[model samples]
Target chain A: MKIRTCKYFAKQSVKSIWRNKVMSLASIGSVMAALLVIGIFLILVLNVDYLAAKLESQVEIKVHLVDGLSDTIIGEIRKEIKGLSGVKDCVFVSKDKALKDFSESLGENSYLLEGLEGDNPLSDSFVVTLEDPRLAPQVTLAIKAMSNIENVVYGKEELEKLLDVTYFLRVGSLVIVAILLLISVFIISNTIKLTVYARRREIGIMKYIGATDWFVRGPFFLEGVLLGLIGSIISIGLLATGYYYIARYVEQQMFGLLVISLMPFQEVLKSLTVSLLAFGVVIGSLGSMISIRKFLKV
Target chain B: MIELVNVSKTFSDGHKALKNINIKIDNGEFVFLVGPSGAGKSTLIKLLLKEIDPDQGNIIINGKDVTKLKRREIPYLRRNIGVVFQDFRLLQEKTVYENVAFAMEVVEASPKEIRRQVPIILSLVGLSKKSNLYPSQLSGGEQQRVSLARAIVNGPSILIADEPTGNLDPDTAWEVMKSLNEINHRGTTVLMATHAKDIVDAMRKRVIAIENGTIARDDKKGGYGI
Candidate 1:
């Protein structure tokens, strides 16, 4: 297409949009609303996934050892534990170090543990980190069956609940997104259908004047894209503002209590921006294409 | 040049609009297509424009068989021919100049060329001063003249007008005819379909009259016969 022709199409599209301001506004609003719903859900799914991943990274198993085991026997037990498939690495935590950690955790009440310095009741243990957090339960059972290992401990119930929630959200989000996208396409196209119907006479005239189907459709195609672009931008602006405030509030309220913090607004900005813009353009163009097809028969 | 060889058309419900039409219009001839309601005159014009295909014949325009032309090639063929309508079909929101310029824009004519050609065509149709006025602001004759300006601005070799003056009073209709005549004088083949008996009898152009599904008369300097 020539530069002048592009200018002409742009001019025609803007003119038509302005000419039917009410319809244009309605379509734009609909697009904005649709994208906003999708955006909110998408942000939710993303943050949940991020939180689950953070928790997974921190997960490990504490394998308690039988007391008074010889150093060589402890070495043999470590070797056996290391041989397991899911075990990434294990660090020996001596009873004295465990006692020190417990005292430190007591903070201002550390004086209560002053008499236990020489004789710590904490068991010797191996802090076991795995290659994958999902293997924690199976790895724990294997370690418990090994000789010299008295017990194995992990946050099995919490991990299972978190994984289940993430999986459910992911599948649910996919279904919601698909449905929302279809509805947006329908609404945007219907809005564009009215515009095309209004100017059908002009289209017929252009056809008789030898205008190619593309030529006749150029302005309308551009109209849809413009509407989509405008809608997406507005939605993005509104969503970002709402998200920023919510993120700040969550951060202040939860502080260090949350195992995985809500993702910072800036962290998700680029992806959200790119996805929303792309979504708007694709939906907008597709809507116009579908709407204009029936009228181009002339 | 336009030629229809043994062309025929039947609607889906079995209405035969044209039967074995064989028309050969030479280049630069001014012709009139006359008929009463449902006499197949509109169908014949549509066939010539390649708007509807003849069920069992060939339509040759400028020596190319339009019936065999691919769908993508139809626009290029149409670019070589201009068309006007009884309704004047101007974009109501556009000013007179933009309405004419739209034709050139459709063909992707260069901006400089559009800027040059549009004014000349507008002046030729005597709409130079009214170029800024919208269609609704113009009189019927003036609107028709604007349509005339648009039809010829692309310099098509053939010009087809379907009831170009249908909505106008006789005097206003004559003003539009004068513009059509002026366009014809510039060497465009003009084929107009209409029911106006007086204009036909006075113009003395080559007349092809259709009754029912066939040509009833093809007269050199024909009148609107009873």
Candidate 2:
């Protein structure tokens, strides 16, 4: 084909977009809404999984010392534990400090502990962190056999529950993504088919005039892509703003100890834009092709 | 030149539209394809355009067998043939100039050539002043003229007009025929299909008349074979 002919078809494709204004708007609106919803869920799930992961990293086993252990013994235990490659940090907490901390956590129950409070029932021990949180059990076992250590307590149960939650979320997110993508394609295909049905006469004319399969189909395909692109942009913009407030409120009100990264706004937008555009382009083109296929006999 | 030998088109519903059709149209000949309604007139045109193919037969155009042509080669085949339709199938959104330029565009005519040939052809159809007018803005006769301009802009050797004057007043129909006659006089083959006996009588061109899907008469100078 000549360059001028290519330009003509390109122009015709653009004119076609305006020719069927209502259908075009409908396609773009629905695609945009769907993309926006999917985008929001994607961000939420990703961040929740990330926050859970951060919680996992912080999981550690606390090894308390026996009563009347010497300062030298405490120091020696700390050195030995730190020397272990998987151990991250080993903070030594005295019994008195532990009692004070427990009282604070106990809130109004502190009055009930008044008899035990002055005596400092808690023992001094190392609040041990591990380089690999999964090695918490092994690290605790090693510490329990130490001379001055009396007991070992950590977020063993909590970490296990956290892992369960992460596993569920990872699986659940994939299922949701798959369902959403399927829904997107189905809705888009129907939307494009309606557009094609409306323009059957134009298609007939194009075919009778010897318009190639691509020439007749190109504009509609382009419209589908443009719809997806515009829809994704609208969705991403709304998602970013909405996510900012949601993340801020969640961070402020919930446990700040396990803060979630909402992820940088720029990265989310850039990736969503590319992905949605690709999605829209493929879906739109596919929808258009499927819709117009019956009419493009020649 | 166009040649159709032993062409037959049967639909899935077991209706035969054309039967054992055989005809040859040489370059620079103006002919009329006439018949009653549903007489397989459109089917013949479709076979030539490959809009619908024949079940059995050969269609040779300019010494090339179109029956064996690839799917991609249809556009190139169309580049050499121009068509004016009954309803004046002009792109509704486009202006007269753009509509005429579309044929060239489909064939990839350069911008310089479009700028050069578009106006001269628009004038040939007597639509020079309406270059910027949309199809809806024009009268039925004027719209058909725009269609004519669009059809002939590519300077095709053969022009297939399927009932070109079907929707026009008698005066307008004559005007369209006059435009077609002028093109024929310029040595371009014109195959016009019409049920209007008056136009065929007036033109006195070679007429190929079909009745019930088979060639009934081929006249050197005829008037609708009435």
What is the C-alpha local distance difference test score of each model? Answer: 0.87, 0.78
Clash list (residue pairs), candidate 1: none
True contacts kept of 2: 0.32
lDDT of 1 by residue, A165-278 (tens): 878877877787778777777776777787788888888878878888788888889998999999999999998999999989988987765556887899777667999999
Supply the TM-score for candidate 2.
0.84
> What is the Å distance of residue B111 in model 1 from its true position?
1.7
Tens-digit lDDT track for model 2 on B1-226?
Answer: 9999999989899889999999999999999999998999999988888777899999999988988989888877776788888999888878989888877765556788989999999888888898999999989889998888777788878899999999999999888888988888888899998988988988888999998899999999988767
DockQ of 1: 0.74
Score every model by TM-score.
Answer: 0.87, 0.84
Give per-residue CA lDDT, model 1, range B1-226, as digits (tens): 8999998999999999999989999999999999888999888888777788889989999999998987877888888888888888899878999999988888888889999999999988888999899999999999999998998999999999999889999999999999889988999999999999999999999999998889999999899899
Q: What is the lDDT of residue A247 in candidate 2?
A: 65
Poorest 10 consecutive residues of model 2 chain A by lDDT?
A255-264
